[model samples]
Target: MQKNKQWNVKGAMRLAGTFHFLHSCASGCLLPFLTLYFRHLGLTATMTGIIMASRHMLALVWRPISSVLARQHDKRRAVVVGSLFSSASVVLILLLFPSEGLKAESGRCNASQLNANVAEDGGEFTTLENLPQFNATVYSVYNTTVVTEQSNDDDTAEYTPTPLISNSTRSVRKVRSLQEEHPHSEFLGSLKVMDAQHQMFFLVLIVTGFWEFMAVPLEWTADDGLYEYLDFVDATDRHRSAKIWKQLGAAFGNGGVGILVTGLYCLTGTTAEFYSYAILMILTVPAAALLPLYLRKRERRTSGGFKALQLVHGNSQALLCAVTVVLTGMASSVVSDFLLWQMQDHNATETHMGISLALAHFSQVGFVPLAGRLARFLKYHGWLLVLAVIALSLQCLYYSFLWGPWTVIPAQLLAGISTGAMWWSVESQCEDIATPGTEKTMFRVFELLSLELGAGFGSLMAGFVVQKFGLSVLFQGTALILALWSIALALLKWKIPRQRRINYSRLLAADMTEMSESDSDQEKDWLETAMDDSKQKNKWTMDKPSK
Candidate 1:
């Protein structure tokens, strides 16, 4: 009985759900916190953006290789390995967390010395503009010294070493003079200091990206595996059910983990928040290992990962889909990376920021099911994309003019539409059009490409914009892009030939029917062969009865 019930379609879905939930918990810990952590390290906006971009940018090289490996090896094993690496990366990030504080301490020491000098000068000016000029006179120090001389005949005399007199001019006055000579010297100086500080954090950023590249694909494979398993089992409402479970997991991760981490951050403070992240990442490893056990034998069989290539080429709709996905990603990155900053900019606490994020994720509980229902009606599969555009644009606009920390709650509630609807639509459409053996592989490839192009570039671009402009400009610019993209999508939909708007649901139903018939026929053939063999064995036994 235990053997008979070892695994089933429902069991596989449950496992997939578990994987998503744990994965979300791990990511939630990082997403809202990591960028702020960088800022806390005294890293400038550009460095923070670079770190965010690098997380996805590195996937460019690893994604293809990872997909190939998952196809060639056991995807479960691949995911387990990725989880272990993720855990390592989290621990390393935690270890490096103290470096920021140390650097800050060093800066404070420098400031203290300057303060002492100012106090000694008895300067009364309180502002940089009204600060008095320092005298440029050189200061000299003299000390007694003894000298020894040796004769040409190698005679030596003993002597005591003493400090030598020295005279040096302090550069403070020169720096002030230079400041007067060059109006932009302060900015230049700051830029130089920022460059130097970046050198220290660069390695940390690279290490952070390492696990992200590894874990993201592994998680995608596992997540997509569940959907593929549902298809293999010929489950009813596969698309909707799979998305519901996935979103449910996300809701749990985002709401529960988001609040937990936020509370931890507030309790332990920003400097120690990495500890919470590391602990959460450690939990993902065990969760990932359970994925393979849920898959049936046939589902576990290897197919080439590169099989996705057939669908990617010459598919115009898929191409358009990619464009929209990229736009959505760019807009989403602003919220994920800097929403906390925006909250703090409004004088909100970390707890308030966490609540806002939790609200966004929790809202998905309501919309994911709605997306599933909407999918039942749309034959073309593009309606969800439309919803995604409108919702995402609205969310971006809301964020652009966000009034308070509490405001993020509404913005994130709108976010549920974008995340739930877009993710469901993308996965469902890709699976709907994918070739039979390439569903899993195609999902992995598409996810990597879309996220890297969209979110990666978005973070990098946002960083540069934030550096040059400000956060307000960044949000407004992002909102404008999304708004224009939405208009473009509407126009594209209108231009589509009426005949070309195919009925995706009918195609999906036909595909399911064909698969079910094939399975039924195979089962019938196996049973008939078994009965014939049993009859032949009985005849042979009767023929040998005389013995």
Candidate 2:
């Protein structure tokens, strides 16, 4: 029995690891390249910002609604599978949208008609000058025509007669007539092109919004379901081990797809990012379906959100942590949304971006195991957060001075501390303060809500800044903001009294006591009910003698 139980545990871990790996693979295939794809469709920086911001903002609404519906219906697995499938389907729909059609139309319209007209004139300028329709002397230089109109009063008109030009100006007179007659038509044509581009922009925006709507619930549901299952199996300690698989999967997916796309791009001038994303997502459906569903009975707590707010409000450190998280999210969003765009502008290939991102993920994997030791060395998670923010500020400052695409590669190494360690510290601190039953609520409020809000606002701000001042200014500005914010956090950490700080050991003791008391009360109730049943049976037996 012991051996069989151990085998089941191993099997469950393997199943979870597989699911996380595939899910991360699907995400890495497309997400990093999504902004580049938007650029391929000719979206400006401002328009791209709007789309990205809208997705994050809408996620704030969709996440909770999806959570509630899934819980009420008890369909967490169904939700995960359906969300993945739907997200894949959305990618296919995105492919059907027209790309660069307006630009193509404008290109065709601007083609030079002068060459054909000159060829038809038989290379004879004298014949063209003698024609009644050619009263003006057209001197064309470099495709530009200077028309010298002859007045009926020859005495008043000044004309400098020169040697006949060569084939270059042969059809200048004819080309000038065409332009004169169709000026309004050309102006109206440009308006139509602009209008078409705008139409395509809005269409892509709507599709992207729907994509986020389907995709937001995936992480929340999958993580929650897996955590609950681990708890049921008494292997909650293995949760972090399972997450390591996710990071490895992300690294492989990102690096592998990067190399794949780079090869394809060279051969065919096309990318396979969307197709790869769809395929990977479809592959994850099976793993997601087979994941363990322990369904531990949980009492519905309507006041979870209220309690979460109260905890943050009552704890000054927790409030500061929330603010720091928001700032971190903003910094992260700015980098994720625009880093590739900047690299592309600097002539960076698809491979360069892919390898850089893979390195970042690898760094994350490396840091996750060391997070505890690092926190201990720093003496507090708050210090870790502050240091992580400082690292991010330095990274952003480095990005602003990029001389080539390759230069950005080294900056990504900082992602380990800036992104991975920072998030770990934030989660650890939040976990320490979270009330036992409201753990999920606290995470949602501090991690998800704050991050999303920061991301949305940052994307919006970045778009306008990039549009007006360029990418360099945007990066430098973000660096400055983060640097100032980190200093403020450090000051707060020093000024706050140690007595007022949250004590993790005390909180753990309280939580353990509460759990024990609840279990004992439940046992007592069961014993009382059993006693009542026995008394009833005895009374019935005693009364049966009369019968």
Query: How well is each residue in 1-547 modelled by candidate 1, as lDDT tens digits?
Result: 2554644666766665666666565556555677776765556677788888887777766766665466446555566556656654654554544433211112123433222223333312121112222111111111111112122222211211121111111233344467788977976543332323454466568677765765655654564455555555566355445455544544444455445544554244453445545565577666666664323444445554555655655466666677788788877887788777776666555567666676676677677657666877875567778778888877767776777758677777887788778877777757655765565566656666667768888898888887788788888888788778878886786675322324444444454454677674564455568888999999999889583
TM-score of each: 0.68, 0.74
Instruction: List residue ranges in candidate 2 displaced over 4 A.
Output: 1-7, 101-194, 266-270, 296-303, 498-547
Clashes per model (N, Cα, C within 3 A): 0, 0
Which lDDT tens digits does candidate 2 get at residues 282-359? Answer: 999888888875553564534376778888888888888888888888888889889887887666777888888889
* lDDT of every predicted structure (CA atoms): 0.60, 0.74
Which candidate's lDDT is highest?
A: 2
TM-score of 2: 0.74
Instruction: After the best TM-score superposition of candidate 1, give how far the Cα of residue 41 lies from its true spot, in angstroms.
Output: 0.5
